[model samples]
Target: MVNVFEQEDIMNTLKHMHKWFNDGLINPDAATTDQGPKWCVVSSGQGFPGAEVSWATGRGKDVYAEPFAGPLYSTTSILGSVNAISASSKYKTEALKYLEFVNTDETMRNMFAYGIEGTDFSKNEDGTITRTENCYSPATYSQATYFTLYPVAPNAADQWDKVEEWNETAESSVLLGFNFDRTNVETEIANCSLIMSRYDKELYTGTRDPEEAVPALYEELEKAGLETIREEYQKQIDEWLASK
Candidate 1:
């Protein structure tokens, strides 16, 4: 909740980025060009271990991924994929039961995730799955527990076990499960977002000097009521801590 945008460490990092950009170490079109596996020599994104297999296979090139830092478990990560029942739903109980069934029943979970078993995919004798042509491949993680879904070939059968171990060892954030309600600061949040959109991309991508750009951005955010938003966040966080 603290406004760390103007902190020394952040400023230093931006300064380094600016230097890199000027020295031609960073892509010249970094601020404007679209970047992805197919577009850039290097790109950053979130993915679990062993995800490179799929990325490599899809791109027909060797793709490797390494974590820059250890995993940190936080509210954002925990809720990255979630199922929510509508507050005004008439069948809230049935919805809850259905969600429970999806998470608990392997057959139901796989069907919901990968489609009809024989038609979409076939189970291997060694326990992996082979997806057929025109297979229904939705975002599997969002559907149910990853452990319940059978592993596709080239990905280890114990990949989910490794993920579980990774989760177990992840450092838990103090703010885990602390939801920040932005209802009171909606106007300020909107205004600040607009202000940030004008300057953040250029500054972060090293298209602008942080020394001059950061101050300008900060001033505009303050004018857009950034302090009010910060204060509201701090208040909620403090109350949440007290409850804990």
Candidate 2:
């Protein structure tokens, strides 16, 4: 399956994904997964499961496939901001024209999959659209809801054109929001987070001693940047709680 996480949210999403796959899909012995031959078309993420330590060398076969998804700072690839503060306003219409193109007034479909026109989906002879995927429905379900920060490319296989009339044109909620600062504790958090990582894998795989390992982990985190991170987080939480 294609990646569901988008930009700035890949790291956290990968943690959940790792847990989901480890339950049954990954071959713990092989340190790999079971999605064989399934091409992983990743978008805007990084450090996918099993990439750092598994099936990379030796004669071992990959139990699953994973693609890298990062450096994805923008969808600026296909569209340009019509209201860009350029040195001159000469190209204003040119930018707007490009937006119009991707908006489906020009291209019938988006780079993301819209659907396979007829076999698996179609515009019902009744002026409505329909899809016949084995057990999923974009009309009622989607992969993007989980990671609201980014949306996966639409399925190109569908060949469905963009519904220009329905695109929710709006400003992004976080467009001008301030990002939380944690550089002061980044180093500590990284080291302590590593301990937590090991703890998670060990707890799930039932290798490390849970009682001993977990407590030891907290002790280590206490020494790591965790306390500082906690304080920072607490400050934010306190502010939000007070406001509420």
Candidate 3:
């Protein structure tokens, strides 16, 4: 654990990192740079379907990876986004049918997931798909279930299988089932957000020193009702725990 206030520890680490970055030794957006520095990092989703397509289509440079961190356990696996046909829509039934079709029908799902196949992507002899040179659509299939989408290369054919395996074995948080309803605490949250946004934009980006800035940030947050916000969340969490 790091003592955030300690100048020689966390603060020094930030300063050194900022200095290296200023000296051009460190890359901030290391994942998505088109410059193709000797080394970079990207998330799993970005690594496979993202950079692969960019490199293939001449839009971005190629880079290789050696694991910097690996096999980490997920603390939560809850779906943060929900997709559904609106109940008030006139075509609600049709919409539901379409939703069902997309989830259950692989062909339809692939059509939606990857766009016009041969134009947007080409099927390889090995069964993995590659993005076409003129494929304008971005692969953002997170809106739907991952399993339903077609497996695009340079992702291994078994990538989805690996994802499922990892999820099955991953750790769960103690607050797994707890969902905080902020209806009663919205004002406090908004005020706290204002304070956080004002400071975090600079403080986290190494533009502001942690020593002078973090304390002031906290002070502003407290004045903005962060304590009240925390208390309300804790109250809800306690009720959830007791119910569990």
Residues 4-58, candidate 1: write the lDDT tens digits.
7768888888999899889998877878776643544565777776778877777
- List candidate 2 stretches off by more than 4 Å: 1-93, 104-107, 110-178, 237-244
Poorest stretch of ten by lDDT in candidate 2? 142-151
For each candidate in the order shown, give its overall lDDT on alpha carbons: 0.84, 0.43, 0.64
The stretch of ten residues in a row with the least summed lDDT in candidate 1 is 34-43
For model 2, how does the per-residue alpha-carbon lDDT over 1-244 read when each residue is reduced to its tens digit?
1112223454344444456445755445422333443332222333323332323322243334454433222334213322343668688778667545544431133122344555545554433444455622343122111111112222222222221211233234321222456767778778976877766654444344444555676677778866778787667656655665
State, as a TM-score between 0 and 1, how close model 3 is to the true structure: 0.67
Predicted candidate 3 versus true structure: per-residue lDDT over 101-216, tens digit per residue: 77788777777777787788888887678877657565465446677665677767766666667556655666767778999889888987777767654554455666677788
Error of 3 at 125 (Å): 1.6
Tell me the TM-score of model 2. Answer: 0.38
Give the C-alpha miss distance for residue 127 in model 3, angstroms: 1.1
